[model samples]
Target: MDSRGLIIGMIILLQTTVGILGNFFLLSHYLILYYHECSLKTTDLILKHLTMANTLIILSKGVSHIMTAFGLKEFISEIGCRFSLYVQRVGRSMSIGSTCILSVFQAITISPRSSDWKGLKTKAPKYIGLFLSLCWILYLIVNIIFPIYLLNKKVKSQNMTKAKSFEYCSPGDRDGIMDSLYMALFVFPEVLFSVLILWSNGFMVVILYRHKKQVQHIHSTNVSFRASPESRASCTILILVSFFLTFYTLSSILNACIAFLNSPSWWLVNINNIISMCFPSFGTLVLMNNAPTFSRFCFIWIRNKKSPNFKVAM
Candidate 1:
């Protein structure tokens, strides 16, 4: 009815749509990965796993958010809350882990043959499953205590203090320390991944420029696309990194606004929190679709063609 209500509604609508679409596309990717032998490359597997994690995270948070929007805060019981929270946290953490690994993997893949990282390509594929397994186990262990301590069906009123907030573990206990430690664990990895992604992309840009100059020196008349699919995969990775950075910045700014405003306006707070989720939902769709090079490759091959390249071989 008011401007704030309108904003919240729009945010929910956009997030729900994007979540549905993204999940569908993720499922499609999984099916392709499983059925297509040629698509079983290590990077494809990594992206598939990342997509799966992203889908779960979206589903867990998006469903709860929709219920909250619809005035159904108690849509799930206490046990449900614990389970949902556990799954959501694990899924979210796995998404972060996968992205971090992907950045490092890309950097290694692009390294020259003389570089030490060139040897990593042989080992990385073999270890992808191991990395995924470790992520699942680590997050599961860290999150298991949540259901034991925090979730209860006895609904408490939303008080003015953050002190009364629902928690699976006591802030005074070892669980609190573990929580802080888990947050710290992600900080360095996240920063490292972000930096590696930036650096890898920078190097690729410079190489492309130099390659273009070399081509021009030959007095070539035809326009040439120099990037291989592997290089294009790096571009996809860059798009993903950009997507993550954009929302991370936006959410951080909005979170700071909420903390500083210190207002008791329920509608305003709700809208603010909802915006943080909505943009990422939309962003996942954009990033996935931005892989035009991949899409064209898929289309040509799926059509039973040998190659997708017009002027050269794919």
Candidate 2:
């Protein structure tokens, strides 16, 4: 309706479009790779779950973009709203949980000498399904109230109305309780997991430095390929964490600004939607990058499906 809203809408549209395309490509790659590789290992399973989570987030973002574009509130039906919000929240939590597990698993895999977790690496693959099941159950039980209290359209008191015209589901109903619970349930664990991931990464970095120093002392100029995979994975994790942290900080600042102003501008809403989708979109990007060969294989399969068949000359 205003210049600020228009600008924010355009930016969100651009970001959402890019994120959707990027994630779609990544999802396709990983699915194909999973089938071809057929590992069924813990890492593979965790990655598959992560991809599924990203796909759900992409769907959520697409719907949100459409709603914003049309200036529509409560875009979906009541049931649809409940389902969408449920899936979005569950998917996001799954992504975080799976990532934490991944980091912990990798750290265990690399641990030297006798550590409590090191012995579990041999059995990690067996427990992946159990871990995922637990994650789903925990989040489902906690967020049961989310759908009932937050999603559907309902009447609000005159005190809560902006125009005193009609009733709409107020965004702030679950604000106090949900915010506190979210911090305790999700945010606190995320902080602890991130710290562990960083510490594990630091261990690997120190080892790499020492390894390089030893090689230098011998006047050896050969590049060590042994460190490549671990290094790459560490770098990828760092970038993923960095992106999540940056977006989370930005969202916090935007929220604080809105609170300080005592009113939310249309631009702030658009920006919030955009930033909310950032971590999922970027996680999809990193996963896709890690599976490039699978992307090529899938492309070839698609092209072959559309081509005419030819008979062999005998």
lDDT against the true structure, each candidate: 0.62, 0.63
**Model 1 lDDT at residue 221:** 61
lDDT of 2 by residue, 1-314 (tens): 66665665576666667777876776565576555565555655776677677667667755656565556766677666567767777777776677777766665665554656666868876887898888888878876667776644354766354431111122444457767877897678767766776676566566557656755655545744344555556556556655665775686677557655545665565566678777766666665576444456777657756774732232
Clashing pairs in 1: 150-168
Cα error, residue 160 of model 1, in Å, equals 7.1
Per-residue lDDT tens digits for candidate 1, residues 205-308, read 66556655765665646765555666677777777766766666665566456545545356545655565565436645665676773566457446654544
At residue 212, candidate 2 shows an lDDT of 60
Backbone clash total for model 1 is: 1
TM-score of 1: 0.76
Worst 10 residues of 2 by lDDT: 163-172
Q: Please identify model 2 stretches exceeding 4 Å from their true place.
A: 113-117, 151-157, 162-170, 175-184, 201-204, 211-226, 252-261, 290-314
